[model samples]
Target: MTDCLFCRIVAGELPATVVLDTEHLFAFRDISPQAPTHVIIVPKAHYANAVELAQAAPALTGELIAAAGDVAKQDGIDSYRLVFNTGADAGQTVFHAHLHVIGGKPLGPSGLDLH
Candidate 1:
């Protein structure tokens, strides 16, 4: 896990524009912004992906979702999109479990064509 990018971010070894930091979660702006307001919310604890995190810590998974909602409200965005790419084939460039909160604009349909 030492080489995990998200783990490094959580440990303060990597620099990230932090938006929210709770005892169990850390939310930061994505380095590569796909939308006007894009944030990546990750658990302080490392998990390979959504399935892994949900299986091991269901409560934490729920907290993550709630945190995303809180972030949307804080950003004053009533409509937003939450995306979780589970595997490499699904465009998960990072292995760590995280949620991408995208808003601040009228988004188009999310499809493979976009990628």
Candidate 2:
């Protein structure tokens, strides 16, 4: 996990605008946003994707989801999209397990058939 981008962020080797940080999670703004309000929430510990994280630490998955709500609330949005791209074909560019909190505007049909 030494070369993982998120691990670098969690360890402070890189810089990201932190949205939320906790004992088990770290959340930050996406460098290239997909929405008016776009943030990526991640576990401090590395997991390849959501499936891997769930398989390993099920309850931690709940924390990740709960953190997403907290993140959206803190950002002043009640309704939002929580996405986990589990694989390359699904648009998961980063290898680390992360949740995307996207909102802040009216979201209609979108890319990847997200209608």
Candidate 3:
């Protein structure tokens, strides 16, 4: 976990455009924006993926969702997309559990094509 990117970000060892930071969660603007309002919400404590995070800390998982919602509201986004890429095949490059909150424009009918 010490080498994890999100963990470093949470520890303030890396620079990120932080949008929200709480006791258990950290939300920041994605370096590579997929949408006009793209943010990545990550748990302060590292987990390999969504399933692991949920299994180990359900409450923190909920807080992640809540933080994402709060971000959407703060961004004034009426409709947004939440995405979790669990593995390498699923486009999860970071290897740390995180949520992608994308919106601020017509995101289209399907969210699958997003990467």
Q: Candidate 3, which segments miss by more than 4 Å at Cα?
A: 111-115
TM-score of each: 0.94, 0.94, 0.93
- How well does candidate 2 match the true structure in TM-score terms? 0.94
Q: In candidate 2, which residue ranges exceed 4 Å CA deviation?
A: 112-115
RMSD of each: 1.8, 2.4, 1.5
Residue 89 lDDT, candidate 3, scale 0-100: 89
Consecutive 10-residue window with the lowest summed lDDT within model 2: 106-115
Query: Could you give candidate 3's per-residue lDDT for residues 1-115 as a string of tens digits?
Result: 7899899999999999999999888999988797889999999888999999999999889889988889999999979999999998888889889999999988887644433
Give candidate 1's error at residue 54 in angstroms. Answer: 0.7
Q: Please report, as a residue range, the 10-residue window in candidate 3 with the lowest summed lDDT.
A: 106-115
What overall lDDT goes with each candidate model?
0.89, 0.88, 0.89
Q: Clashing residue pairs, candidate 3?
A: none
Instruction: For model 3, give the RMSD to the true fold.
Output: 1.5
Which is the better candidate, 1 or 3, if ranked by TM-score?
1
